[model samples]
Target: MELFVDLQIASENQADLPSLTLIEQWVCIAIDAGSSKTRKEAELTVRIVDSEESQQLNGDFRAKYKPTNVLSFPFQNPPGITLPLLGDLVICKQVVEKEAMEQNKSLNAHWAHMLIHGTLHLLGYDHIIEEDAVEMESLETKLVLQLGFPAPYNEQE
Candidate 1:
């Protein structure tokens, strides 16, 4: 798996996030769960944006008019390609930080959870239906636990 991360946020605090190695591990886990067969090579872009940028993207793409914690824009192209372009993940740093503090979870853990969630979305996982939500959440729980974070749904009070 080849992961490319571009931190769009200019804040110095963003530099304190988990290393690229950790992000790669989490992406691989998400890809394994999402894909029917293990992918040989994958390419993904993760962008850490601020609340304003996130809100714009949400409003433009989803018509939500609000900043979301994470957004995944998956790509579909011809098959039999050597490198597969999965999609892009847009994460709102402000929302993530606030949610981490409100939920009493470590910043790193929450970030990891969001990244996993977004990656799953890129892999074509959706939580719109009850059964699908259960399936997606189950995968997320297992993967997040492996990454040293508590189950996201279980963390809800």
Candidate 2:
């Protein structure tokens, strides 16, 4: 899989973040892990924002009022349009940082999990159902592990 990412940093507090190239590699690894059978070019946008922006977007798009870690907006290209665009991932810096600290995980590791999670969602993976959740989580574990990161759902990570 070939993946291209357009990164946007809307967070005012320019905290340290993984390089854009690294993020692109992570996303490609995730997409490949989830759909190795297909050969396609993928494009996506990754936006890093503050909690307030996350909250507003969550409320507007997901009907939730609170800020979450990551939100995926899969593109809705019409029936005939054949753009390789996958979707947009809106990530909250503050929430991710807090969650990592509270969960006793490294920021980079947690970010890797979020990136994989969101990218999988873009690749048509859903976790709302128990079985699907297990499948998606399993794939995430494998992908992150390949990158030398621990399984996200494992407590010992």
Candidate 3:
């Protein structure tokens, strides 16, 4: 499977942000692990934004007033049309750094988890229901662990 990512950095703060290569690797891991069939090519965009944009988008789309770590916007293809376009992911760099410090997880690990989580959402995996959450988390954990990162759902004390 071939994956193409258009990484856009709109955030001024790039402290702990992952490189495009790293981001692509993490996204590919999720796609390979989640997809059932092999594809010739896939395309998506990853946008890194600061808190203000994140908060605005979160409030507008999710009804949440606070900035979120990541937001997944899956592309909906038209009827009788098929394309390699997967969707887009907007990641809040500040929120991710804050969450990583608060959660006591490595910055790279958290970044990987966020990308994997967002990619799963693009693949139609959701956590609104308990069963679905479990399945999604299980897949995320497996993929994260395979990347040598701690299980994302396992909160450290």
Which portions of model 1 show Cα errors greater than 4 Å? 1-15, 78-83, 155-157
> Which segments of candidate 3 are over 4 A away from where they belong?
155-157
Q: What's each prediction's TM-score?
A: 0.88, 0.94, 0.96
lDDT of 2 by residue, 71-145 (tens): 999998999897888899999999999988988879899999999999999889998999999899999998888
Score each candidate by Cα lDDT: 0.81, 0.89, 0.93
Q: Which residue ranges in model 2 land beyond 4 Å of their true spot?
A: 155-157
lDDT string, candidate 1, 1-157, tens digits:
5555544453335755666777777778888777887776788888788788889999999999999999999888767654578888888888889998998888888888898899999888999998999999899989888877777776453
User: Which run of 10 residues does model 1 get worst, by summed lDDT?
Assistant: 3-12
Error of 1 at 149 (Å): 1.8
Q: lDDT tens digits, residues 107-155, model 3?
A: 9999999999999999899999999999999999999999999888864
Clashing pairs in 3: none
RMSD of each: 2.3, 1.8, 1.4
